[model samples]
Target chain A: MRLRFRPVDTSFYDLFTESAGHLVRGVALLAEMLSDTADHDNVAARMREAEHAADETTHSIVKKVNSTFVTPFDREDIYALGSGLDDIMDSMDEVVDQILVYEVKVLPPELSEQVDVLQRCAELTAAAMPKLQSMKELEEYWIEINRLENQGDKNHRRILAKLFSGEFKAMEVLKLKDIVESLEDAIDGFEKVANIVEQLAVKES
Target chain B: MRLRFRPVDTSFYDLFTESAGHLVRGVALLAEMLSDTADHDNVAARMREAEHAADETTHSIVKKVNSTFVTPFDREDIYALGSGLDDIMDSMDEVVDQILVYEVKVLPPELSEQVDVLQRCAELTAAAMPKLQSMKELEEYWIEINRLENQGDKNHRRILAKLFSGEFKAMEVLKLKDIVESLEDAIDGFEKVANIVEQLAVKES
Candidate 1:
């Protein structure tokens, strides 16, 4: 008879929760960046730091998964969750980078709607990560994210229509459109994260 | 002990191959749409058909994965590969639709370089899908794709430089930049697919 002895590690759940916490901070900075009276230098710097912190957490998760033969969940699920979380941060960081690089002035009021959706998603995701081990109470997290994504989509279409309605100059329209699409991508990225979490819960349950 | 007998379904490889075939046709139509003498309606119709076909194959893969207890590889990997392939096609289709809708008269010469990259990636990806069943001889496919993506990145930077170099009108830069970025996205997506395939191979080997 062969005996197996492997201690299940619960640290991954803690790491995932920590990573999601960075998302909360990242999105808050994103909202600050979108503010009209913002200091762009400080906002960009803070977002950059948040993104780096998120990256480190992702790297830690990947390393732990690679070293441990018996994981808390499937290997690919861990990878997918880590990558999904990292991608959302990347999208948020890109929005801030573009705003700075393009020297975008005259911020759109419509962008606030997308930021609002993002903040809600961050909160939901941060809340959901801690419950991953229990595999309970995650249904609402994903459902709310889906609803929020739909809201972001509607906001995106409205913003695009306004951009093409000739209210702004052609140059401003171009600059604003990139920022708008980045926000949309960030929102969609959050939905991807939520979908992965839902799948993980189903598999674990 | 319980006895288990489940047949391995190989139809997934065929469906994936079929989906990659659509990518080949999709990118080719995208190239045709960029041509100065393109028959826009016919090309759009064909691209739409290609996108629909790809979507159907993706749905089939997901359905099969859901119903079967044993998949050929990780379920998440299958999902990621399917969604990745579909995303590349979607980005290609968006490029065509934007070009047509924007109704820009002049197509930048740099765009042809991007189209060339897309066509090559489509070819490599289609050729690699059949090998998924064995996961043999895949190293070259991903290496070539990574190189091509780097090439695409360079082309993207040059195109952006040209657009903002005061050589183009504000409206023209806006219209063309969107199209260029979509091409870059398609190229990046191919790399993503290749990366997923590499990971799957590593796990399954």
Candidate 2:
């Protein structure tokens, strides 16, 4: 083990935790958007607000990193992790927006399954943010997130195969495909954040 | 400008140039894939080879970064640039593979236009890699890439609108959309590389 001066800044953790909190809300909105009775316009409007709020959290992380004399981890790692979280929100928001603008009347049930994966990833990620301070017991967080991402990947291919299975109209397939991909992108974004956290743990350890 | 001890390791630049060189070939293969009389299998096979070769170059850059004590630029930036180039190849390869797998026939002419933008971006990137050492007159390279990216985006939206225009069959639309998005992704990959180069120059200056 290497000994170094560790200056503790609790706000970074607090801000990251706050950031993850927004994702929790964001995922809920995403789940709501997938509901059959979803008010597409209302859900999408709220999603936009949630995404903007997530962006603010990201910007706060950046500002804190710039102003603070010492960061909890590396400056670059902080930026990567912060932006990684923000990217997830952007993807989720894209899904909602696609559902709205494309006027996709019926979303496949499998999409909800993918959102379920995102919800789990979000919960895991939210639970893991504060754990950044200890850098202990972090491995399981990334490992589980990776597992969920793999499941999401499987779900994605299954969805695509179905989309091409001659069930839905080509036009509907076109619109739904965008939503599906955005869902996949959001899941991938979570995996990226996990990777960043994992890397941070490795560097810290 | 800040004066810092700059150690020149020509290999990193060479490897980057070599990586960008693969993109040039990759884009050419992409163009060939779009031809009316082109052998889709052969073009796809060649693209796979090009992608594999690009992967080797990326690995070489990583290995060199790990072994070399003094790099030309930041190690992260080097990794980012090398992988950025590699990602473009991956997206191109994906486009080719999708065409082959989906058996998409009669591709839209708009796709060829997008590939034209990619070819231009690849050529400019290949031209710009050597300029990393001087970091001079490189602004035009990124500016051109950004301009081409905007052009590609416009082409992408036009292609999407056309795909959704009720002309092609839904199944065909599904197939072509994958190829179209992959092409757009490749162009976006180029823009990302340019952005990385721009940031590198800013850091160096």
Candidate 3:
């Protein structure tokens, strides 16, 4: 069997970068909602809007994948990137939903810090995605993404430790713990995106 | 450039099947432990042993992946399978750890049922793995695995709804909620293994 070689189109790369940017924007919106002192319904509505936008962006990428015969990266890589990005939005949406439904009034300082780390991690992930189209120029960004992920992990540990300290009331503890876990999950999704980008860098190199 | 086609050894498939079998056994042990009225420490110790065994099995698979020149599936597929199987053990271990550390005395009825479902999911997943080595022989089992996953998902939703019904005390509710979520997570891991097996079936077909 003869292997047909064709350079992957630049547009697919652009779509992927766009998707990553949307994910970053979604995380930023989530952070803003978390930090907000407004009514619960208002914050939840904003987070839901962010999730809807991320969903639309993911749909766009999927449509491109369905129509294109060739992709800039492996088909599985593209799917993973799309799914991983969407997971970040889903995680945020879940946290927001829980907060609103439970009417959780107080936010733990530790959980607040985790959300901040998650926002920064998403930003780094978004920054790294564009560089993937030109792997040679983006090698340093991959390293930076890894560093940000490590920082997120550290924050996760700190938050978990505080949750187990028996300081907060049981209900407060449960609410804060779930929020922290979801934030960590969002960061994990970002880390997966970075891992895929690093794999792309290796393949390109 | 000529693409080199290296034949995959059957032994790796065998190893994965064996590792999956170990995971099923672990889930079974967990279900039994959760149902038992025995000493909490003993139950936790048993769960820890199963997790350690699964970890060792995962390490073996990783070693095989690193040293083997040819693989039966894509490298990413192998990694996904390895990690997916390991996640089951990790999730179960975490649940048991939480139960023990939190001094949780009473288990929720619905959560126990989910544990049963998780055990069955793991068993079906293990059953499906050996079939991937020769996909034609076990197509029916692969379908069954998917059906079982869907069933597990339904059970998860039902249990989660029951958990938040405002029946239990605040601390009790929190503990039950965490356990239910953890069990669902374990089932999700099992479903992921089934998914990978289904993917392999597709490739083989």
Candidate 4:
């Protein structure tokens, strides 16, 4: 029996960038949902719909990974990138799920701030994705991504510290805590993506 | 101007694996600290020590990455793996730090159980690291790792459901929730390591 090797394809990169775009869209939907003064059920439904879209995008990437022989980058890198992107979506979905499940009616000011930062992080991540395929362009975006990630981290620490202060009611604190942590996790996911792109640039150079 | 390429050395792989070993040890230390009925300050110190060790390990890997011309795995994979392993350790440290900061006295039953699971997951991750260097051996351990990960997921879901059942005191519920989520995140980190190992095996085959 003879073994065959397939030529590497760049399709995985395309699919991955597409998935990142979906994540950005999902986060955008979530931002809108959070901003609206809608019923909990309606907000929950919209959040679920956004999550479903992210899941579909994730499935597409997974299928591409399983079928592709040659990937533009390392197969593991592709998987990491895919999983990192999915994690951002998952973090957003988890926050919405918590809000609905806990029957949380009010969003804290701190949580709103975290969500605002998260939306910015998602936007930056989506913008950076297209530039990943071009190493020259990566340098331009990579520094910005890192700066945004650091900003997210600072926001996370600020919110977390405020969460522990004896100001808010117990339930309010609990709700805001979860939201802050989820937002931080989502930003961390974006940072992971940026890290991968930066490493790719290093490898290509 | 002439460009120079240095020959790839085994040092990068050596440093990465060594860093992985350090991470596994850090997690073990965290688990031990969690299970101990030690003073709060003592536990916090111990956790901090583990974090510092893991940070030192990360520094070593990063230094090697900066200087190395070639790596055994994708440079991004190397970075991802290193960062992921460090993340698991950091999450473990964070859990312990929270316990101390929050002045938590008794361990939640669910969180204690998850710590045991995390220990097992870390051990599996450590065992898988050497096999990653030899891709042919990865498949043998892949199933076991996945099985363990599934078990961790089951535990996560079970505990989370219990959390929502209103069985514990409100403050207890809040603290335990954070600890449980962190433990589950650590397990997910281990599962990520397994996933990457499986990908490496497939690519090698």
Residues A84-174 of candidate 4: C-alpha lDDT, one tens digit per residue: 8888888888877777787777676666666776777777667777666665566656567667766776566556555665666787886
Ranking by TM-score: 2, 1, 3, 4
User: In model 4, where do residues sit more than 4 Å from their true spots?
Assistant: A1-167, B1-10, B59-67
lDDT of 3 by residue, B1-205 (tens): 9785997554767777877887777776677667757577887888878787887777777667766777788766777788789888878876776777666777876777777777777777677676666676665665676677678788878876776788776666666667777777887787677777778767767
Q: How much DockQ does model 2 earn? A: 0.19
Scoring only chain A, what TM-score does candidate 2 earn? 0.94
Task: Residues A1-205, candidate 2: write the lDDT tens digits.
Answer: 9776898655988988989999999999989988999899998999899889989889989999999997778898999999988999899889988888888888878888998999999999999998988888988999899789878976876787678778888678878888888999999999889868865654454
TM-score of model 3 vs. true structure? 0.65
lDDT of 2 at B90: 78
Location of the lowest summed lDDT over 10 successive residues in candidate 3 chain B:
B136-145
Q: Between 1 and 3, whose DockQ is larger?
A: 1
Off by over 4 Å in 1: A1-105, A119-131, A134-178, A202-205, B1-10, B37-53, B100-103, B136-166, B198-205
Report, for all candidates in order, the number of backbone clashes: 0, 1, 0, 1
Which order, best to worst by DockQ? Answer: 2, 4, 1, 3
| Candidate 1: residue B76 lDDT (0-100) | 75
lDDT over C-alpha atoms for residue A79 of model 2: 93
TM-scores of all models?
0.67, 0.68, 0.65, 0.63
